[model samples]
Target: MSPLQKIGAFGAALAVSFGAAYGVGALVGPFDSGSKSEAKQSAHQGAGHQEADAESETEGAASPVVPAGLQVTEGGYSLDLATTALVADRAGEVRFTVRGKDGAPVTSYRVEHEKELHLIVASRDLTEYRHLHPTRAADGTWSAPVTLEEAGSYRVFADFTPAGAAKNLTLGSDLTVTGAYAARQAPEPVREVTVDGYTVRLDGELVAGKGSELGFTVSRAGRPVALEPYLGANGHLVALRTGDLAYLHVHPHDDKAGATKVAFTADVPSTGSYRLFLDFKADGKVRTAAFTAGTDQHAHG
Candidate 1:
C-alpha cells in the first residue's frame, strides 16, 4: 500500500465522525511474527465486528471519503502477518494476527457483511486476486489457504472491524513470493474480462478524488448468469492501484441482483491505473472476474 495521505476536507472530523475513536490503547512494540509473548499476543483476541461504515453510500461507507487499504496500522489496530515471504506455486497457509492497542491478539469481532473478517490477496500488477475469510483460533491467529502460484510481490489485506468501532479497518502488508519474478503492466481499461468461461464487463471509470459510479455484468456464452448473494451482497469489489497496490474498498449500492449484473460505486483518492477484482457467487461456487481501469485524469480526452 502507498503512504498515508495528507489531511484534507475528509481528513480529521470526517474520519472521527465515521465512528472511529482513538481508545486508551497504548503504543506497543513492532509485532514481528505470531510468536510474541502471550502477554502481548493472546489476551485481546477481539471484541466484535461492525461494518456500518465499511464504505461510502455511493461509494461504500456512509458518505464518500478517502480510500482505505493503505496503512498497516490505523486507529490502534494492526494486521500482523506471520511471514512476509512465500514460495510460488505452493499451496500454503497464510497466518496472521490482528493486534489491538493493548498489543494483544484480538479475539472477538462483530459480523459485518456476514463475515467476521475478510482477507484479500493480490499481486502488485493486479493480475492475481483472492478474497478469503480466515479462521481465527482462540489464540487470535487467523489462517487461510493461499497459493501465490506465480512469482511476484503480493499485498495481503485484512478488512474487518473490532467490536465497538464504527467503521471497517483495512490494513495491508507486503509479501514476497520467490521464484522467478516477471513484472507486468496492468491491461488497458476494458469493458470486459473473462475467466473460467465467465465474462464480466466493467461499466464505469474511476474518477480521481471523487466517488464514481461502477457496475458489472456477468455472462457466459453470451447469456446473462444470475448472481447470488455472497457475504451478504451480490458482489464484492476490490480495487488496487497498479504499482503501489494502494487499496480502495467498494460496495454494491444494494444486495439485490439481476440475472447477471451488480452495481457499485468507488471512491478513488488519486489518478493512475487500477486493477479491479469482482467476486460473485453462482452455481454453488464463488468466482472472480478481473478488469483494468484508469482514472479520469489519465483517461480524459
Candidate 2:
C-alpha cells in the first residue's frame, strides 16, 4: 500500500478502537441515561422524607447549570499541570496532561473543531490572550512553547472531548508569572478596535443567560475589507469574562465568505465585564482585534 494510504488506515483503526470502547452504553443509551441520572439524583435527595425533597426538586429544576472552565477537575477529568509557575522573560515550555478517572493520562480523544485539544491562556486583567494547541506524545504528555512578557496571574484552560465522554469539557487552572506586576484596568467599554491596520467595530450588548446578538464589520484604509473564512467560519470570537476569565467560544452564524460583516450569538453565563477577541483573515493573513465589553447588568449607573 502507498504510505499515505497506510497512514489513513492507521488513523481509521485508531478512531474505531476509541469509539468502540466508549460506545458501551450504546445498548441502553447510557450517555442519555447519564443526564437523566444526574437530574434524578439531584431531585431524589434520598428516601427518608418527601417534604424537603419535593421542595428541593423545584429549586433544582430552576437553577442554571454550572458553567464550564471554572474548575480544574470535573466529571472525572483533571487538568494536570507539570509546572504552575513560569519565568516571564523568555520563551518557555509549558507541559501538562489530561488524566482520566483511571488516574492515568488520556491517550484517546475525539477531535473537535479540527483539533484533538485546545489550550487557552489569558492574563487576569484581560490584556493578553493566546489560543494554542500543544503536541501530545505517546505518553500523553502535551507541551507547547509559551511566552509571557508581563508578570501577573494568568488562567490556563484545557478544552477537549475524551474518547468516552459525550460532551466537550473545559477545565481551567491558575498560572503564576514571577516578577513585579501591575495590572491594566479593563479598557472602557468600546464597540471598535484596531489591530494590524484593520479596523473592526462591534455591535450589540451581552445579556446574561441568553444568547446575545453580536455583529462585527471590518474595514481598512478607509474602505471595507473583504473577509476570508478562517476556521471554517467567516470569523472566530473568543470572549473571556473579566474576573474569572470564564471562556466562551463563539462562532459566526453567517457562513458567506468575502463579506465584511459577521454575526454571532453568545450566551454569556453571567452579567459582567468581558474582553472579546475577534480573529479575521484578510489579505492572506489573520489579525485579531480586541475590545473591552460590558453586559446589560453594567449598563445602568
Candidate 3:
C-alpha cells in the first residue's frame, strides 16, 4: 500500500468511528442509567463530536470565493471558473449563490469551519492576497465586494461546511484580473532537507518575489505511498516562515489513486526559505511529513 492510500484508509476509519459514536450517543440519549456524572459525560461527548465534525468541515475556511455545490457532475462538488484573464482593476464586489443538489435555493445556514464562509483570493503569480466573507442574501446566494490593485491569474477558494454535514469541503476555481503590471520572476532552486519520517522534494522557483510555488512529494521505505484524507481531504499542509512561523494553511491539489503521489502549491511573501509540515494518513494512522526549501528570484514575463 502507498502513503496516499494509507491516508485514505485512515480517513475512512475515522469517518466510521465518528458515525458510530454519533449513532451510539443518539441511541443512548433516551435510555440512560440516570446517573448525573454519566449524563454529564454523555453530553460532553456529544458536544465534542459536534465540535470535531464542525472543525473537520471548516478546515479550509480560508481562501477566495468558491461557487456553491462544487462536486463533480456525478454528485461531487466543484469550483466553477468563468474566466482566466489576469488584469488590474479596482476592488469590486463579486456575487455568488448556493443551490441544493436538486437545484433549489439554499439559505439561512450555519458556519461550520471557523467563519460562516471563508473566501481567499490570490493571484496565480502569488502576489496579491484577500480574505473576505460574503453576506447571505434572502435568495440563497452569498455576495461579497472586493478590491484588487494588481493584475494576474487568481484563484478563489470557498471554504465552508454545509449544515448537518460531518466534514468540511473546499471548492476552487481560477479568475483573471486585467491591467498593466510587471510579471515577477521565479525564484532560484534551494538545497533540500528532510523532516519527520517522510521525504519531501521542494522546487524553490518563484513566479514573483513574494508569490511562488513549492512542490512536494512523500515516500517511505524507498517506495511511494498513497495519502488518505486527514479531514475529509487528501492531506493537510501548513506552512510557517522561519522568523515567526507566519502560518499558511493549505490543502492538496486533488485526490490520488494510490499512496506514492501528492502535490501542493504555496505562496511566500519574500525571497526566503520556509518550513513545511504535511500531515498525511497512512497504515491506519496519521503521520507528519516535513521539509525546508529556499526561494529563488526569477520574474515571469
Candidate 4:
C-alpha cells in the first residue's frame, strides 16, 4: 500500500476512536491555528467524562494535527498572486494579495512571529526554497523581491492570520518560472548536513499521525555553536512532504540564547519522505540547512 493509503487507514482508526463526538482533522492535516483549536475542542469533547481526563485535556495534551499548505484557498482566505509566472535566473519582484471571503483584498492582519505575512516559495522538486517577508501595501497587495535560481514549477505559500481571527491560516499557490527546466532528484535521507561552514545534525523520528520532537544542533570545527534568535526563536523549520509538498512552518519550543540545540514539535500527516529546511541566525548572518528524511522506516509496508 502507498504511504497515503496507510495514512488513510490511520485516519479511519482516528475516526473510530473519536466517533460521534468530533472529527478527524481530515485525511491530511490542515495547517492552520484554527485546525489546532478544533482538535482541542475534540479532545475536550472526549468519551471519558472523568474530571481527571477533562483536566488532562485542559492541560494541553491536544495532539498537533498534520499541517495544511496544499491549497490556495482555505478558511475564506485566498492567496491571489498578481502574476503566476516569473523569469528564471533573473532578479524580480513577486506580488500577491490575500482576498477575503467577500471577494475583496484584505488589508488588516495580525502579526505572528514578528511578521504580518510569511511567504515561502519552493521548487516543485523541493531542491530550492525561500522564506521571505513581503511588504504589504495600503491596498492589501504584498510585494517581495525574489530570484528563483532555476526554471521550474514552484509553490508559493502565504501564511498569515487576519485581524481578529481566532486561528492562523496557510494557503498555497502555484508559480511557473519560464525557461529550460531540468529536475533534480530529491536528496536521500541524512541526519547531518553542512551549510556555510556550519554543520547541523538532526535527531528525531517521524511517525505517521504522531507528534514527535525534532532537535537540531549546530557546530563549527567540532565545537558547539551558540545560535542567535531568528523569527522569535533560536531557529525556524520548514518541512515539506516530498511528493505533494505539503508544508509545515514550525517554530522551536525553546529559544534560550547561546543554546546550540533547537527543538520543534512536528506532526506530519502521512508516512512518506520529507524535506526539512532549517534557517538559523549565527554570527549575525542567517543560513539555511536542508535535510531529506522519511518517516519511521518500519511504518512503510
What TM-score fits each model?
Answer: 0.75, 0.75, 0.40, 0.77
2 against 3, candidate with superior TM-score: 2
- lDDT, candidate 3, 75-101, per-residue tens: 233333333343366756656554557
- Most TM-score-accurate candidate: 4
**Model 2 stretches with alpha carbons more than 4 Å out:** 1-64, 298-301
lDDT by residue for model 2 (39-73), tens: 10111111110111111235556423445577788
Screening candidate 2 with a backbone cut-off below 3 angstroms (N, C-alpha, C), the clashing residue pairs are: none
Cα displacement (Å) at residue 67, model 3? 17
Cα lDDT of candidate 3 equals: 0.41
Worst 10 residues of 4 by lDDT: 15-24
How far out, in Å, is residue 96 in model 4? 0.2
Candidate 3 segments whose C-alpha is farther than 4 A from its true place: 1-75, 78-87, 186-301
lDDT of 1: 0.61
lDDT measured at residue 53 in model 4 versus the true structure, 0 to 100: 17
Report the C-alpha lDDT of model 4 over 1-45, residue by residue, as the tens digit: 011111110011121010011111101111111111111111111
Better of 2 and 4 by lDDT: 4
